[model samples]
Target: MASTRAWILKSRPTGMPDMGNFELREREQEALGEGRVRVENRWLSVDPYMRGRMNDVKSYVPPFEVGKPLEGGAVGKVIESRSPHFKEGDTVFHMYGWRDQAVGPAEKFNKVPPLGVSDEQWLGNLGLTGATAYFGLLRVAAAKEGDTVFVSAAAGAVGSAVVQIAKAKGMTVIGSAGGEEKCAWVREIGADAAIDYKAGPVVKGLMEAAPKGIDVYFDNVGGEHLDAAFATARNNARFAICGMIDAYNGAPQSFRYMARVIAARIQLKGFIYTDYLPEMGDFYRDMGGWVASGQVKSRETIHEGLEATPQAFLDLFTGGNTGKMLVRL
Candidate 1:
């Protein structure tokens, strides 16, 4: 029997996750069962959402069990298929990530479409990450032309998509990043204003960019960035809460401007991208056009090999990657 390497959860973390929490193990492949397929995973996606899954507590998704392989998203080629839906050499995307190879029921995998981009892009800009930004900014926030929009963690995968989409729609986009280099990249990606949130108070930086007020906010970092958005939002402002990376690793957060939500009549909607699954065709059509026409660009920070997976996940908290972070298997 052939064997494959997989990263398994060894222990749940109390705060920020460390390499000790994961153990790389070799699993011998078993014979394929009826209606099953074997996959040779080529790329693995390490996302912030997986951090929450590491915990034992109940949440939107099931927790990653100790001694078992951790999963997120992966792109792979079907090596063997007993099902009629897929065949050998067909590319697919599935949740059985964090492993060099995986075997599962055919229904567990979704066929990857032939988009004009690399297979890695399907895990990023052309996939869930991109869909998140598309639905979060447009559908949840209801951003439109001529609106002044603010985005936190603007250099990240989801945030960068929001910035470019808003810009393409003729919106005034204000992006907040950790440092000058990231801020410069945000501006280069078509943000009207790029605030280095680490340089000063987020509220101060946001105010300097949009003195009047912002019409929409695409929140990736919560806590302080949320406070700042509340302080600078205009009446009837819309907020799409995609992620609160600030509080992801059990960090304490205080929302001083929470009261402003009521006073300003702001609509704050917290959403998971899966909630918009029915509308994915819209996203593929719109975002695909934007990317094809060069209105939206994709960026990725690659971490080579499966051994770097744990560090890649930890780096999300440190603002280590520019856009989507992937570990090549």
Candidate 2:
């Protein structure tokens, strides 16, 4: 019999999450019931969206309950299967969370191809992060070739993908990152220009970078950046409201909410991938083909153990990673 190591949320976070909010506990593993498969979590994804889930607030997803192993997207190998379709040792993607193991029905997860460019890619460019970039940019924003694109947090996991994807689509892309190193990497990955958001007035830097206004804004960091996007957006420009990394770690600001869209005549839309899974098929197929053809470049930052899950999850809010942040056990 195997024991399960789990991280349970002890307290809700006020700003950035700390170790005090989570506690580790060990419990005996239960037998798999009919149609269930037991998973050994190999890689867990830490995302900015998680901060919202940590609080007892209402949003697109339900808040994580106190005293429970907080759940998020994870990919793992099936160690035991009661289901006929999934066999032992098959890898699957599921919302399993900050834990060492999980037992759930096969339908609760999606199986990934065993081998690839990298396992981390399955959680990044080819997984939820990739899907979000694909749909959010092309579908929601309706970005086209020749469109000038601006992406906030442009050196992170999803941003890395956006630069390449939009470039492949023939758009002129500019990215806003936090430092010179990140800015350089953004250019290395194909962004025409990369603005250092921490350098100064992002609006001024963006104005100097783009000059002609941006057609689409893929906003990962919101608040002041959103205000800036509204100020310089081209007429009829679209804004894809993804996770707001900026709002995750600080005092919440509610200004410029109405003006961002109304004054700019912007089309702003927020989405959850579960609502867009049917649309995900085309993205997966296209993104896979792109990966196969070497048209897209992806990066993933992996923390190496279950004990490291707390810091890994906390890093997303702090922008402590480049590319998709995941923990590899």
Candidate 3:
């Protein structure tokens, strides 16, 4: 029997998670039953939302159980297959992440199409990160051309995609990141203005960037960023509440400008990327065109080896990654 190394949740996190909360264990793989496929994961994704799963709470998704292997998005190659749906050496994307090897029903694995892009791109630009930006901006926020859009964490995977997609649609985009380097890259990626949130107050910077107020807001980091958006929003502004990475670690989020929600008539919608799975084909088509035309680009911070997965995930909270944070196994 073959052995596989996997990361198991040792305990639920109280605040920000640490290496002590996880345990790496090696286990023998079970027989590949009929209609099942075994995969060797090549790229594993570490997203901010995964942090919420570590807690024992009721949410849109079930919390991660202790003593079980953690799961997320992964792109792998079929090493063995007993199902007619897949063949040997096929590249597939599945939700059996955190483990170097995955074995499950063939239906859970989707074969990645040949789109002339790298395998990692499937986990970055063409994966859930890109999908979130697409639906959150264009569908949830209803952002349109000529709109002045504001996005938080603009150097991140979803936020970077939002900046580019908004710009491609002829919308004026203002992005906020942690540092000058990140802000510079945000501007280089077509943002009309990039605010360094770490330098000063977000509302102050946003006011200077767009004195006329913003028509749309794509929020990744909540709390202060959300408040800033509320303070500088024009009437009838649309807000897409994506991930609240700022308060994900059990931190309390206090918004003083929430009263503006009524005053500005702001339309705010919180969404999960899975909510629009029925329209994934639309996303692939449009995002594919933008990617091929060089209107959209992908950046990633990859940690080598499966052992580095925990640290990579921890890095997300510290702003250690400029774009998508992934583990290359």
Q: Against the true structure, what is each candidate's TM-score?
A: 0.98, 0.95, 0.99
Candidate 1: worst-modelled 10 consecutive residues by lDDT: 112-121
Q: Model 1, 86: alpha-carbon shift in Å?
A: 1.0
Instruction: Write one digit per residue (lDDT tens) for candidate 2, span 187-260.
Output: 99999999988889888888898888999999888877787788789889999988787677675755564575
**How many collisions per candidate?**
0, 2, 0
lDDT of each: 0.92, 0.85, 0.95
Report the lDDT tens digits of candidate 1 across residue range 169-268. 8899999999999999999999999999889999999999999999999999999999999999999999999999989888888798889998899999
> How would you order the candidates by lDDT, starting with the best?
3, 1, 2
TM-score (C-alpha) between model 3 and the true structure: 0.99
Model 3: per-residue Cα lDDT over 132-152, one tens digit each: 999999999999999999999
TM-score of 2: 0.95
Name the runs in model 2 displaced over 4 angstroms. 254-260
Maximum-lDDT candidate: 3
